[model samples]
Target: MLAATKRVAFGAAVMALAVGLAGCSGSGGSEADEGGTKGAPGAKKAPGPENAVRLIGDGSTAFTGAQPNITPPQRLKPGEKPPQFVVFSWDGAGEDSQKLFSHFRQVAKKYDAKMTYFLSAVYLLPEEKARLYDPPKHDIGTSDIGFGDTQGIKDTLRELRAAWHEGSEIGTHFNGHFCGKEGGVGTWSVEEWKSEINQAKSFVENWKTNADLPDEAPLPFDYAKEVVGGRTPCLEGQKNMMAAARTMGFRYDSSGIGNQIWPKKTDGLWDLPLQLVPVPGREFETLSMDYNFMYNQSGTTSGDPDEHEYWGNQMRDGLLQAFDRAYEGNRAPLIIGNHFESWNGGTYMRAVEDTIKTVCVQRDVQCVTFRQLADWLDAQDPATLEKLRGLKVGEAPRAGWPAFTATDTAPADRTEKH
Candidate 1:
């Protein structure tokens, strides 16, 4: 999926119209407050000052209270079975005529799931303000995907505000959708990538100033703090991009390919690569992304309408098979990537929606954003994680978790025995 030639093209008019628009702490409690049904002894009260909202930079973003609907991550107890994690993420997420972004938000809510929307910065910059973006290696104001119009920006903002309030994460897909060798992201240097990252941040932080929509309510969360990770454009330039991301305090990078195994750190950051999954009715597997599936199934974004339903079922079944492999075996996190476009008569959308409804409601299954997944990973004990990493793709611990982790208590003895 990281191949430069895998880039998808969008209509210029569609691109021009989509410019888009578009934390907490605790403290000690008093004795009376403790007994007054407020909270347990020494437990922090809910809805306290930690939820207070503080406006930031041109009022484009704010430090709203703790994100709603996100459960705090707890360290996994020794020998405990891990939850089956499934992450459904979208690239270049925005609102347009198709309404795919908003539709997916509703789908997530219905299934008790949260998603990561990797927004393209240009979607917020109105077509009139195109010159504000100086894309790396591209001509001034030149974006392969054009800027959004006023109405498009307004709709995107509405959806973004609502999505965050519902506990969904907002990430970046960088600026331009540049891929391949000619000035594409694959050829970018660390410095060029840094410039692009900064520009992406700047566009989000100054949307109000640049677009002149002063009266609009500020975004609910601070972009700088909210955006801790992102998938690079077309999944290219990942090596240099990771270098830039580490310097920018990013916690994870999801722009590579890997098998269904536990994630590990790269350059001190989580390398949460997309995994290969079964392709229904086929002997081979493919990247767990809608685009990859579409490419393999139809060889183009828009395929035969007569086979749309079949394609949808194929994707849905493939993802489920992949989910079960990890769920019943190694228990590795399943990462699924998608886009907002209605490829193959919107069959992929339907497939994803059905997948969410089916998988998220199952026992011990958590459909979460990359941010939440990263938090859970960070909260676990290193030894347990190391044990998890030892499991090969789809390979469960034959001795079960109890015996598998029993060596933690006698590391030195285990070493000597080995």
Candidate 2:
């Protein structure tokens, strides 16, 4: 393990802030942060219906921590700021025939960017990166089915289901790879959406339900978790899709990147928005403005030294850009996007490796996963989440000292929070 960097004072700060949080809302309790500090946990009210998700700082503040394990240097330093630490993530976390995942993992390992790759069609897809880690940072995944060929999508899902026993999670990647700008992410027919989810779950979890294996070898991922923690084909930000996801038993979706807060069209599922990943965007000039991007080492790449050269370099720079923005704007996390297939091309892998090296050495940033972020939010005071739900600079009275822990009754409500 890379030498653990000295911890930050966020814990102490959190405690102090919790007091005020408790003031405005009735949320209080203990907190556990390794060698940090311990406070109180909120009282467990009746588990509200899915739509009644009432928790402070829920989903507002998060850390997307993950990177492929095979890439080169990507270490994070203490007190490192975003651009680097403000990590985002990609679903379909797996090693393809081109060794894309292995390459990206190297980037993750170096930067300490704890990424969570959503596993899906990576099952029998192809092992471009030979002799890879059995479970490639397999956290949760989307696009379980729909491999385009439609040929063995079913068989492939079966093998993946076996891995699911260990730690691979499944989510929706789209009804049938129906991606692109105009794709009907939130506007898909109800039955079509239902079929997409139902099929993926059924095929992906075949071993779980019909397994005759001994109980000792538990599954790798959680099938019962509704693993719907992903986005659709296109980056079409829509409320209808959210509402549909909720109705379909999904708790979260990584579809919305730019937009913050639970959209009004929520179907009760959590929106984990996909910010920007490392893959190249539009063209050369479109590089710098590449705030939110996706990466895959399997596509066409530019060797342009500045912004176009190796996508890896561009991503490193992008990380810096995101950090500056978050620090300047107080944004807690930065979500990047990518695809398993994207990392398959020629130069793409090299770019991924280089980018990984850049992220590993950065400081102050804590790479986290979607689930971890949600958990982090779940642990925070409800009021804080509300205040941050739709973070806007002009929205006077930003988060400050004396972190409020109590949401049910907080002082901020009277003064500025509300």
Candidate 3:
């Protein structure tokens, strides 16, 4: 475990800036094998009676039916053990020169896994129209990470359309990558946060006009209804963000830090936070993220060439350890965050890919998006969830899975809507 002092210091440093599957096998079967009634990514239609697709503002997005490729969650039967859940989310997700956004979409398909992509609003807004963004405390056209180029915006739109069809959740990362105390998200009020959130949706809901790509196909889902939650930039302003979000119908927020334990609702939103995992051979732990690994390993994005491999392996091992603790012990969901960056020779990216390949194929594991996890959480009985939350990090029920979750009350007729 990380000492309190070091954890605070390290978290602050990492947050000061740093903007950025499975089916084939296993005892429980891959997510693809679990429920893949929908056709391939681009072929599946949204679920609806008429299955009509009405275009929203400027035809940037459409009111497609329910998202495809996602299976509605079921309540755990009496004395049943929970399946291990792992969420691999990307921050500032956009397809740029690196092509990582599209690359990972293919990777998820191959592994039979699904993920969450926290799309930064600026990614869909072309650089030429940067002035369109009205960040809370920053000047007009001011963005710490800047806006994407024309082609980058188009490529990102294509990926967003396909990713949703493939069952991945598209959450917001808000607009502008502001951090620290001065004019950062932390200082923004709830109203300001609401404004930021609205703008984020606006950029996506009207990307066709904003980016001048009238010929591009409309995004498959409505941004207003599709986006159920998000992580604040640098994980700041979550308190205010959640306050603003809940009233706007958000179901969860992933902008806090926690240990390996089942989540609980806070302020009416499921608080799915990044966890503190071991840093390989080190005594202290760091947040389960790529930038923290880079910060602790070399304190620079361009670290020693020889140490890149070691650093990558260290991060991979640390995440695996975190997964193992929850998979084999408490059955808590593992929340991991990353940026679409190639810092440290793209070592962290490689590490993430390796981790996905390793864990997504394991028996009884489900690599799903935050929204999916929230749906599962919602299906559980409140008392059952309270009991599950009683277990400490990495501490399994001494009575065993069946005996521990055993309930005498009649089960609730709960059903999840993907």
- What local lDDT score does residue 407 receive in model 1, on the 0 to 100 scale? 43
Candidate 2 least-lDDT 10 residues: 20-29
Give the C-alpha miss distance for residue 148 in model 2, angstroms.
Answer: 9.4
- What TM-score against the true fold does each predicted structure earn? 0.86, 0.53, 0.87
Best model number under TM-score: 3
Candidate 1 deviant stretches above 4 angstroms: 1-48, 407-418
Query: Which candidate model has the greater lDDT, 1 or 2?
Result: 1
TM-score of 3: 0.87
Per-residue CA lDDT of model 3 for 134-206, tens digit only, reads: 8887899877777777777777777887888889999988877677688978899999999999999999999
lDDT of candidates 1 onward, in order: 0.78, 0.37, 0.80
Q: Write the per-residue lDDT of candidate 1 for residues 20-114, one digit (tens) a residue.
A: 00000000001111122256789765655564668898988888767777899988887688999999999877777777887888888889999
lDDT-based ranking, best first?
3, 1, 2
Query: Which run of 10 residues does model 3 get worst, by summed lDDT?
Result: 21-30
**Per-residue lDDT over 1-418 for candidate 2, one digit per residue giving the tens place of the 0 to 100 score:** 0010111111111112111000000000011111212346863444333213221121211121121122223322222221223334544443334344444544554455555555542232222211221211221232213122122222233323332222223354432333322332334555555555555455344422232222222223334353656655444434555655566656666665433222222455555654332222423211111212222221122323343445445555645554444544534455555554432233333443444454446554456655555545554444455644544421222343223223333445322321
lDDT of residue 152 for candidate 1: 69
RMSD of each: 9.1, 16.6, 8.7
